[model samples]
Target: MKKVLIVGAHGATAQIVTARLLAETDDQLVLYLRQSRRLAQYADNARVTLVDGDVSDIEKLTAAMAGVDVVYSNIGGVDLGTQTKHLLTAMQQAHQTRLIFMSALGAHHEVPGKFGDWNEQAIHDFLPGFREAAQLLATSKLDYTEVRPAWLTNTDEIDYETTTLADGFKGTEVSRASVADFMIKVIADPSLYRRESIGLDKPGTDGDQPSWL
Candidate 1:
């Protein structure tokens, strides 16, 4: 079975991914988070091994990288760029090549509508870090798939559509559960998407795409 490491595994989206992974795969699971308290909810899950630490800390991340076959990073903040850089460095040193990262739409380019406007603002405020992070991942030797979802909702539905760098999807919004499902899919089939960023949203929606574009 594949051994997988999930960074930011305690977040809402990450929690779904964690549950699905345990239920669906025999893969050994490792969860890395900044706070040990956040992982308390998962203490009883036999499939999950927890590591409490910061993803941006090289030494800590490197230690977590050991014995891990794939790294699924859900870690995100205003300083996404720096955190991504640190992850890339740790993966390089560990020689772990499979990676799946969560990013928002309109990260590098703009979406088409009002939601797009919001996304653009987020990018303006956060893209420097996100762009740099993407650059670091792109330049790395690791096989990667970056999943960018539009506005996130709490719906548990799995209906969604995925596009790769296409335009005009300005009002699309995807449920966080759907995003988690997609992440799990990428982890299972790394060959399906590699070194590419993809856009995700609900299958049918209206008006100025979701904020992520």
Candidate 2:
């Protein structure tokens, strides 16, 4: 069975990915978070292992990565680049190569029109770090897929579209579940987007801005 380690397991998108993994695959899951208490509900699951530690701590992260076949990082924020560095180091130490990272759509400056402008304005403070982190992953030799999700919603629908980095990005918004679906698909098929960066959004929703905004 595949052994999957999910960093930042408490995140909204991660919750959906966790459920999908448990329900669809016969894989072992290690849920890594800063607080074990946050994953109390999963403590009793036979296939779920709860690891409490900071992603920035290589020692703890390396320990948590034992026997992990793949890693999916759902964490975000200003320290994302630092955390990704730590995770990469830990994964290297553990001899693990597969990584499915959750990133934002504008990380590559691929978004277009007024929506792109608005998105850049909104995330101006945080985009640089994400872009740096994306660049790191892009240049690294590890098997990695950087998932750049457009504005996300809590909606349950899984209708989504995708764009390769070369094609540019489309649409403005997509459900979190849709992003999770894409991630899970990539995990199941390791050859899907190796060493590539792609964006996700709901089909036919393209506009000057996300509908909600």
Candidate 3:
């Protein structure tokens, strides 16, 4: 079984990724979170190991990453780029090669329409950090797939479409579950999208602007 380490284990998207990892595979799970209380639900599971600590702490992160085959990071906010450096360092020390990171749609100015404008405006302060983190992942020696999901929604469906950074982003709002599903797929097969930034959106729902907007 693959030993998987998931940072930001307490967040909404990370929670879905955790659930999928638990239900779909026999892989050993390491959840790194700032608070242990948030992951009490997995206390009964023999396969799930919860490590309480900050992602920015290299020593703590490296210890948690021991023998891990894959790393899935879903961290955000203004310090995203800084935090990513920490993750990269820990993974490098552990000699882990595969990394699947969660980044927003506009990190590269790939999103289109009013929704894109609005999304960028809302996250203007956070983009610098995200972009910095993206640059680090792009230049790293490790195999990394930076996930850029557009204007996330809370829908139950997993239907989504994707395009490369060169092709530009399509549609607008993609469900969080869809992004999680895609991450799980990547975990199962790390060969897909190696050293690439993938943009995801719900198919045909939002053109220039999300229908809801």
Which should have the higher TM-score, number 2 or number 3?
2
Tens-digit lDDT string for candidate 3 (140-167): 9989999998778898999999889998
Question: Top model by TM-score, which number?
Answer: 2
Clashes of 2: 0
Which candidate number has the best lDDT? 2
Error of 2 at 198 (Å): 1.0
Off by over 4 Å in 2: none
What overall lDDT, based on C-alpha atoms, would model 2 receive against the true structure? 0.90
Task: Summarize candidate 2's per-residue lDDT along 1-213 as a digit string, tens digits.
Answer: 788999999999999999999999998999999888988999999999999988888988899889888899998898788878888899889888899999998899898888889999988988987998998898887899999988999997999988998999998899999999998998888889889898998998888877876
Number of clashes found in candidate 3:
0
Q: Residue 106, candidate 1: how far off, in angstroms?
A: 1.0
Misplaced by over 4 Å in model 3 are none
**Regions more than 4 Å wrong, model 1:** 166-170, 209-213
- Report every candidate's CA lDDT: 0.81, 0.90, 0.89
- Of 2 and 3, the candidate ahead on lDDT is 2
Lowest summed lDDT window (length 10), candidate 3: 204-213
